[model samples]
Target: MRFALSEDQRMLQDSLAKALVDVSPLDRVRRFAADPADTAADVWQALAEFGLPGIVVPEAYGGLGLSMLEAALASEALGAAVAPVAFLGSVLAPLALVRAGSEAQRAEWLPKLASGEVLAAAAIGEPIAGARDGAGLVAKAGKLTGRALFVPGGLAAGLIVAADAKGGLHLVRGDAPGLTRAVMPTIDDTRRLAELTFADTPAEPLTSNDALAALRDAGWVILAADTLGASQAMLDKAVAYAKERRQFGRVIGSFQAVKHLCAEMAAELEPARALVWYAAYAFDHAPEEASLVAAHAKAHLSEIGRFIARTSTEVHGGMGITDLLGLHFWFKRIGQNRQLLGGPEKVREIAARVQGLIGA
Candidate 1:
């Protein structure tokens, strides 16, 4: 049993990196800032063809049935390229349903999603759920009436929903007669989010504590991987600028201050990278502790990523702030990722609680 990426994984990463670079270039990300339809459709279509859309779906369901670690690695690559596809929303959410859905439901829906015939989304962070003193939502019976905000790729979802009702997960159609979706403005234009309202909409229920938690835990791990990738991009950008930018009589990169800062950023990044891999490793081996470890990974990477993005911009001077130099891409994503998965403080607090550092 080796604990390293196999030859196949490396090949997968290399192939995807080569193909997606052209579609998800940094310059194109800038242009898509205000365009709702500015998603990387060609890239997504290609990925579906590669069987990634069903990476975790079972063979009976038309998926590769790969491990969560594979999904995490793929997610990291997507983030590194700033690819504009919603693997989390499109695949992870449905995988959640597949894990917990009844046999009948799984037989009906999983194949559709695995083949990319129907896109889905998970709506966990509804307004009230994430707001101060927020209480989780419950979907009772067939009708759902509530507001789910900041739902990523919701507008593009064919089936969208994830509300806990009496200790069970609920699913809903995106265009259920009573559903209303409106795209919400976000700093990261590459990823689309929305405000979804379910006005007496229909829903299906899936009951399985083990499966539900497994799927959600997998999502947390993937997000951590995303943060690590984004942070690495920022680090790379800063290093390049330090090497090329001039100051005084020579390249500013030679200055002790710049070197020290870059070194510090590297130091910060290393721990987060370790945490992410460790968490993903835990996801496969230690299902019971995966949630806490995933939270830990997400917490560490998010803070470090934000720090790197900010400093990357600063090192580039005023030019970095301008769209021309494009440091804002990293900065905006850092801010977005900070809020994603509940941020550092939220996750740290949760982790501490899990460890009994504070009274539960």
Candidate 2:
């Protein structure tokens, strides 16, 4: 069967792209990175004005009530612009709650999250490349004590959904009595990551234990989609550079070697897009296939994204490394995206489990 985006989905994607053009240009991204605080308040406000924070939230909670597929489309646009926002952290925390929280919990958190009044971040992957399951924190007597590292947007988040050693999900406020966060510097300045330490921090348990796998798969799918967008942007930049930069009295685009590089990059990235799109669609429609497809998409796109980032930089020669061209933003973003959630090796192992190729 042929898969295609519906008209409304296409329109939503286009609208978000148009909005980012003015709000999160490369110069704006550079400015945010240069600031010590690493915030994009104006750019975030622009996205909040567009109701993106509520895109995947239920309608009862003041959201558009869209599906994961639509959210993936928005993610693509965010990746294309390399916009500095907490979209992943904000969306994933609420999603975990929505999937497993009690009715009271949903009533309290979903509306605020939908309205962008509060931002949520997930502290699932503790050791960067560890298992996506919440196996890092140990819970006792309604309090948690452990360290959760590499939490994206944790320092800026108002609420945090943390995973426990037993696969249980817990919600802890950012200002809780025994919680501390420190920003961790990463290669990608556009995204913020933090290491959180909990010293008997109080937390509320989410009731839905079955939702953990779903949430993990969703996170992988969104990251893959983001990488897909970044890959395309890098390819576009490289092509533009090849067309304009001249060597030996002719445009570099005239050279067969440059043409081959661009062509090979396109060939690798184009198929990866289908994998990401299909993975997102599967999450909404086919539950049995979602995990496997999400893993495949994340693994494949991450590798291709690295290749695109490297090849694109080479296309510009020394100019690519200069801050003036701003190619490093995409390059660094791809580098970080590769290891988030889990690297290709870890994800491929997960996929093998789904296929019964290895013992669980």
Candidate 3:
């Protein structure tokens, strides 16, 4: 009858949060964001040392063999700190390999991926399925050609798990012939996006037909969890500021309006945390409901995340816009999460179709 994180899950979240705070403080994040050449290597290594890179990998391949719930927890931790690590790719690559890859491919890549000896990026956004504005990938004869946009962590990835037209997943080496990566400018530099162009680039395809669907579901859950964490961080900052900021000989926390804003944020965000946890739990334990719940989680959190970000910024007033507080990082992170994979409208449409309320 109880729905809550297990004691072990709580401990995992606490330990990882502490590690992130130590390795990726606001100052370090600012410096990393300012330098295009900076890859946040220290933070990435710290995460790897914490075994996040291998969280979901099967024990046979040296991973912790954890489930999607644990992965969601790790994502929450990352979003709370706005750490600039390539987590999406690291998590998804192993998943793709495990679900769709051949025995040879799994043996060759899983261990390296689990150990963080190689970094991977993901280009599995829905836009990759339908060529738009001259984007999207096409696979033929074990090679891929065309373009994929908004590839996260693509710039530094050694491997890329790309979804091609027709919903097939392929693994493309970062240095594959005729492949080029270009960074896309965005408000949130904490997690960089890239445009990948492949011209007759060699690729290895995952054999399973369901791999892409699994990836999509997992992606939705992870993005939702990330937004939850970022929103919580923003709310925490707003509350902390309200208690200390004084005006008219009284702390801002004494103001009814301020208390209402913080209370509203809490009311909206706390329920969303449950939604994310349920989505993640369903992904691992209730496979039949995973897609629907995942879509709901992602869409709902995107809307709630925006509310928290804006209201939190409003709480800080002028200081929110300034770089000194570094609040914009969390704000921008929420904005980006809102659009990643699928926005609210798109995800809701998918959910509707899943329930037979709309045509696919």
Candidate 4:
């Protein structure tokens, strides 16, 4: 089977790239970053107008009813622009609801999510879990009592898809009586994170046995896609800067060192891009391969994105790290993506287990 994006997918990708560039350029990102609230209301509304918030939701729920590959493409555009919006959480929550929610739950929540009327944060990676793999959440008496750290867009979510220590998933209203949220300090201001504390919070349990694994894998794929997009942006920026910047009476692009740097970034990026797309495809078409491929995609892109981020900054020299150029936005975004949902070491270990290379 061909592993390339279809003509329609390509058009969607192009349109999204252009739309994001127009609405979320560097200056807009800078403004959002500097805003104490860190909200991107205008950009978020623009994306909603494009039906991006529900890219992965089923069509019956007023969504586009697209697949993971389409979601990956949109994510790549958002990452390239480094738009300050909670696209990731919005995408993943619906996936969980579709997989696990009761018919009633899906009917109630999916439409709101599709219309961008509400935001959903994922409460995975509780400290008690000791890993980012969405464990250590405890549910008792239909109530949740645990702390979930690094909740994506938690502070703004109207709903939260939280995990239980036993691998069960639950939908908890963000305004549950015992729920409290606080913004966590992060290296990447563009991706807002919040810490959530629960004390006997009421939660609606989901029944789908496959929900946890599928949701986790979906999250991994989106994260990988985001990094893949950011890496490409880094490569483009580096090449553009090299062609324009002068050193020793010659364009830096003419220098062997600069050429090699840009070439290496491109080399690292190309394979990762293909791998990310394949991971998205596998999630939709090959369930057996989804987890392993997601792990591989996330692990590979995390490191490669770091390299691109650093090399791109080097190509710009002193200006790369400065706010004037806002290259740090991409740099820090890659940095944060590397560690989310576990770093390379952690993801690789999981992949090894999936390959039966280690004991369960």
| lDDT of the candidates, in the order given | 0.74, 0.87, 0.90, 0.87
lDDT (10s digit) by residue, model 3, range 249-322: 99999999999999999999999999999999998899999999999999999999999999999999899999
TM-score per candidate: 0.92, 0.96, 0.98, 0.97
| Higher-scoring candidate on lDDT, 1 or 4 | 4
- Candidate 2 stretches greater than 4 Å from native: 131-135
**Runs with alpha carbons beyond 4 Å of true place in candidate 3:** 127-131
Candidate 4, 1-360: lDDT as tens digits: 776789999999999999998889888888888886857888888998999988988999999999999999999988999988877788789998988899999999999999888888887655312444442568999999877887778888999998887778899997899998888889998878888888899999999877777877888888899998888988998999999999899999999989999999998899898999999999999999999999999999998999899999999999998888888898898888888777889888888888999997
Q: Where does candidate 2 clash, by residue pair?
A: none
Q: Which candidate is the best by lDDT?
A: 3
Model 1: per-residue Cα lDDT at residue 180: 84
For model 2 the TM-score comes to 0.96
Between the candidate structures 3 and 4, which one is better when assessed by lDDT?
3
Candidate 4 global CA lDDT score: 0.87
As for TM-score, the candidate ahead, 2 or 3, is 3
TM-score: which candidate is best? 3
